[model samples]
Target: MTIKNQYGIVKIAIASGKGGTGKTTLATNLAAYLSGKQKIILADLDVEEPNSGLFIRVERKHEEIMYKMIPGWEEDKCTFCGLCQEVCNFNAVLNMGKLILVYPELCHSCYACSELCPEGALPMKKQRMGVLKHFSNGKINFIESKLDIGQEQAVPLIAQTLDYVDKHSENESLVILDSPPGTSCPVIEATKEADKILLVTEPTPFGLHDLKLAVETMEKLDKEFVVVLNRYGVGNAGVEEYCKENDIRIIAMIPDDRQVAELYARGKLVYKKSSAFREALDRIAEYILEN
Candidate 1:
């Protein structure tokens, strides 16, 4: 299934409109389906709250602290000029009468303040954002990041997660990214370099509504993507209708089954119990190869 130009590596991002929409389920299953036959790595980029490993259970191979650069002020230079605060576009730097404050949460690490400082009063300092873990069950490698609880910004941590994947990505293999929900900056960062994205949504009004928003986000990124209608039987007809009207292809429709839900709740995968899901995932692999 390797294309001549493709290094046999496929980067597929599975994202949803909002949380609790089964993005990780589809991502892990897809990676599980490709195990043994192809080199596959599953990355959980939902740094704020990651749970992909609760099911796969790979032995943790490595872990690292992910950090971002924040400005550090030098009071010894003797100046309360507030130049750093004035240059910061994110409002991360604030100056008081004699105290210079650098809010790490609001900083984007652009280094603009340090670059523009006259006396080099500001130097970039590292702040811990999260921890990244690496593991492998022989065939599928897993990497996930967990943002420090109460951490407000996730983009820096998400970058570290992807950086690990990019640095450790297996040659001639596939990378399946489980992105955080919503059309925010973190989600955008996850989907940036993906060759194709699988947008998973249900058949309800909320599903359709957020699906559209996600679709717009993908279009803005100019990346090719397809839709996955999960729990197809329970929701309304809007999912299919919207796909038809928008010329979007429906790659797979997973039925709402008590068995699957129960297995998921127990941290079990469907392929361990049902052959149908395995077959469906094989079909999805073929769809990715074809398109």
Candidate 2:
């Protein structure tokens, strides 16, 4: 069932307002299901802790270290002008009379301090932040980026991963982004350019609360999005009611099945074993193609 759409390179982002809501489950299984029909690229943009590759079996095609630009202080070229510290909004640069310090964790890569330095003492340098790996199993191409253990930021790595996808993917192939869990900067960077976003959530009070936050964020970004309720048979109807009140569409509801959990625990995909799960994936794929 290759999708024939007028839009080139349809990008669908699967995200959640909070963690542990079956976001990766949907992403991995959907990619697996779609790969049976046409070529697809599944990108795990949750660089802080990407786990989509756990459920997938792929051979590594390429790997590279990811870096972010940060100002490096050179004392030999400094005259203690204090310009670098004054221009740094993130407090990444500090002048202590005789010495200067640059914090790579705090730097946002705006290059303000380095670019405006009169003596050119602060030079923009590449600082290791993460690593990106590309893998493939014929039809399914998987890209995963993992942030360094002590890295403080994730947006830079997420941005670079998307750039890699843009360069490698064909205009007609489908690209599914497994975004980070939250409405923060990393999530925004992952989904901002997506053609459509599927916000996954469980049907609980906590899920409803975070779903509201995610919904508000999509509204602010003016993005076209829908909701998917996971573990649907156990929780209350708060998610359904809220979606109805807000006129938000509930695209699919995956039932709470213990068999699904058992397979997931073994790092196995459920679409091949669970008919219910495959039905949900069919609906999701149909929605993506129709819209």
- Cα deviation of 67, candidate 2, in Å: 1.5
Can you list the residue pairs that collide in candidate 1? none
The ten-residue window of minimal lDDT in model 2 covers 1-10
lDDT of 1 by residue, 1-291 (tens): 542125656788999988877888888878876776877889999888899998887788998888888878888873878788899898889989698888888888899988788878888888888889999978889999998876789888887788889888767778889999999899999999888899999999999999999999999999899998887799799989999999999988887778888888988877667766776677678777875
TM-score of 2: 0.97
| Per-model root-mean-square deviation over C-alphas | 1.7, 1.2
Candidate 2: C-alpha RMSD after superposition: 1.2
Candidate 1, residue 105: lDDT: 80
**How many angstroms is residue 194 displaced in model 2 relative to the true structure, after the best TM-score fit?**
0.3
Q: Provide the clashing-pair count of each candidate structure.
A: 0, 0
Question: What lDDT does candidate 1 reach at residue 112?
Answer: 94
Cα lDDT of model 2 by residue, 151-252, tens digit? 889999999999999998875789999999999999999999998999999899999999999999999999999999999898899999999999999989
Output the number of the TM-score-best candidate.
2
Q: After superposition, how far is residue 247 of candidate 1 from its true place, in Å?
A: 1.1
